[model samples]
Target: MARLKTLGSRIKESAGSRVKVVSPGSWRSGMTSSQRGYGYKWQQARERYLRDNPLCVYCERNGRTTAARIVDHIVAHRGDMALFWDETNWQSLCKPCHDSVKQAEEAAGLGG
Candidate 1:
């Protein structure tokens, strides 16, 4: 007979594995987004940036006027607080462009 697997056993398997699994937009440190610097200050900055740059840059390039909903780093910050907070390195992007095109560029090493 096959043995039944409980939730605890499944979690134990993940804990015992050498490779770690992380969800999108989450750090490997397992800290909350606020702890990782997406706290109140970052939220305020993001709101101000989006207000100043209300259209997606990529969409604007294509003659589309999509509303910007995300502020992305032109270069990957990689835990560098200076780069992370640099207003000059920020660009406004629609959710679709940020999630798809920007993510692809970062994955392909073109974002930096």
Candidate 2:
């Protein structure tokens, strides 16, 4: 009987470099979430915004009503606090749309 290779094992076999093990308290760009301005204030603002805009804008455009779970920045902040906190730059999106479409838009430099 042939055994199926695990995804991790297959990836490791195909990839040359070992996966970097991130230590606890280690964050990308050497800055924590709070340092990135996503602290208490942002949380409170996000909650308030979500309350006011309960539906996902993208989903709504597609004629599907979905509850928004993420308050996304229409423009990439890139450490700009002004842009980060700009209410006008905010949009409510469902997890799927935010993670997939929005991420792809940002990657393609179309977002913002």
Candidate 3:
């Protein structure tokens, strides 16, 4: 009887001999909240806001009921610490609504 190789083992064997080509000025990078200098304070604030507003504000407004997974600022902070920390300016949103609709609206408002 033959045993099946695990996916990780197969990937490891194939990756060992591959030569990856990365461009010197490639645009394949992104920053996380912590990488952008948002530390434990930001995380705690987010959690608290989400806890208070467990449902997606956008979805609720549109007559849908969805659980929120992100705490979003009503106005873009644009490096303004005061606005960023304003609890009244926060709203809860699901990942899809935040990523698709809210982001698009923000981008459009920026004339992009």
Pairs of residues clashing in candidate 2: none
Question: Between which residue pairs do clashes occur in model 1?
Answer: none
Sort order, TM-score high to low: 2, 1, 3
Give residue 70's lDDT in candidate 2 (0 to 100): 98
Q: Which stretches of candidate 2 lie over 4 Å from their true place?
A: 1-28
Clashes of each: 0, 0, 0
Q: Give all candidates' CA lDDT scores.
A: 0.88, 0.88, 0.78
lDDT of 2 by residue, 1-112 (tens): 9999766544335564757654456443677789889999999999999999999999999999999999999988877899999999999999999989998997798986
lDDT of 1 by residue, 76-105 (tens): 887788999999999999999999999999
User: Candidate 3 lDDT, tens digit per residue, 42-94?
Assistant: 88888888888899988999999999999888897755678778888788999
List candidate 3 segments past 4 Å from native. 1-32, 35-37, 110-112
Question: For model 1, what is the error of residue 53's alpha carbon versus the real structure, in angstroms, after optimal superposition?
Answer: 0.5
Q: What's the CA error at residue 61 for candidate 1, in Å? A: 0.7
TM-score of 3: 0.66
Compute each candidate's TM-score over C-alphas. 0.75, 0.76, 0.66
Clash pairs for candidate 3: none
Candidate 1 accuracy as TM-score: 0.75
Report model 2's TM-score to 2 decimal places.
Answer: 0.76
